[model samples]
Target: MAAWNLYRHRNSDGSSKDWAVRSNSDGSITTRRGKTADSLPGVSNRYGVKQFDIERQKQAKGYVLVGEVDIDVNGNVVFPGKTSATPTQLPEPDANPMSVPAPPVEALYWTVDCHAKQTIRVELGIEVRRLIGVIQSVSDQQSKPEQDWDGWQQFIDATLNAETFELSGQIKSVHGVLPWLFLLALKAKSFKGVEIDIATETARDLSVDLKAEQDVLVFFGTDLDSIRDTAEVLGLLKPRLNLAATMSDTDDCWF
Candidate 1:
């Protein structure tokens, strides 16, 4: 008898495929792959670290471990915690993507456009106050009541160095910081009301005029694909469509 580890990869469109791997008694590894309902054929030509490498490759391709099962000499699958030899069915696609749990925090990342350049300046007196307010609002929504204020203040005082009473930076130089500027622009809906100004002096300047509210939205919509996650974190927006997929669909028009 050989124990097999099963994995399944579900697509956003509700379709899925199943894969299984097991080590043979003779020190070789056998793997099977096919649709959930299909009788998957096994291939066993590799040995040693190849099995582990294949597992990692499948996981990288978005396959998730389902469970372990044993295959007897008679080719019957003994599912753990179940008497049935039938494989588990793939889950239905989520109609509301937001209902799916967020990716691990460590997996979250800010997307930056390496080619774009712009210098943004936010007036200290009014804009910084509003920025702080927005940060506080986000922290309050995300953090516990007892820790929100302190966390917000420490982030402002230590990480941002906003005590200088002004905020200005080159977008290209600090691409990760684009989300903060985007948040400010997103909240105020205009650069003037927030007292935030943008200068595109560099050779590789942004294609959209950041000063214009409509253009700002369009630019963020089409270019800053990952900012949707940040906006969702700030409670300014809800997760709706897959932004990356949407951008890919519109790539021809933009380029």
Candidate 2:
């Protein structure tokens, strides 16, 4: 016979929002605009299968969701709830914000399973072996040697052989070709700085291209999900590096 209390307001502009009632205590009220504790009790949440499907597509195209708004923790949302319900908790941010690697990133381990097509399975990771670059010889100039024949050959050999590789001293296996396919993987430290780009083709092929850098990492595959998952883990942006913002404006775009 407990009464419902205002736990938090869930609104973009802040009007009457959701509420949660506590069995004991005065109960808590939260504003859809207000800030929640950095550390809230963790809760198990699940996204609709359809939503996850959309996420896969968006990520495949190189988009990411890094911000959350109008969130409520420790609130009762279920209808006609009883007193046994527990408070919701927010996920913990990386302990060392700068040090914590991105969740999904290029050239990283990823396992993907498609519900609709059980036959679709993908595993992505870095290759442990490294290959030295070599040039390809052309028999006839009429055939016109590939623009990047050596580079391309090196790319193919490394990518195929990259079934095993190393990154940051971590040993990982490449399940198969990756989404955002790259001809090869190489260290790009030779360049002072570089911008990275991730792309997908009509054939469902994945490609990652790091520009103007001698050393780089490449992933070749058809699984767009794995490419995105890799980018998410490696912290590399599609053709760019995404910087985290500390503030935002009315449009919700971080500034």
For all candidates, the clash counts are: 0, 38
**C-alpha-based local distance difference test score of model 2:** 0.28
Per-residue lDDT of 185-231 in model 1, one digit per residue for the tens? 44344433232333332111222233343334443333344445555
Please state every model's RMSD to the true fold in angstroms: 19.8, 20.9
Summarize candidate 2's per-residue lDDT along 29-81 as a digit string, tens digits.
Answer: 22222234322233332221122232333344433232332323543232242
TM agreement with the true structure for every prediction: 0.32, 0.18
lDDT against true structure, model 1: 0.46
Q: Which stretches in model 2 have alpha-carbon errors above 4 Å?
A: 1-107, 117-207, 210-255
lDDT scores of the candidates, listed in order:
0.46, 0.28
**For this target, which candidate reaches the highest TM-score against the unseen true structure?**
1
Worst 10 residues of 2 by lDDT: 164-173
RMSD in Å for model 1? 19.8
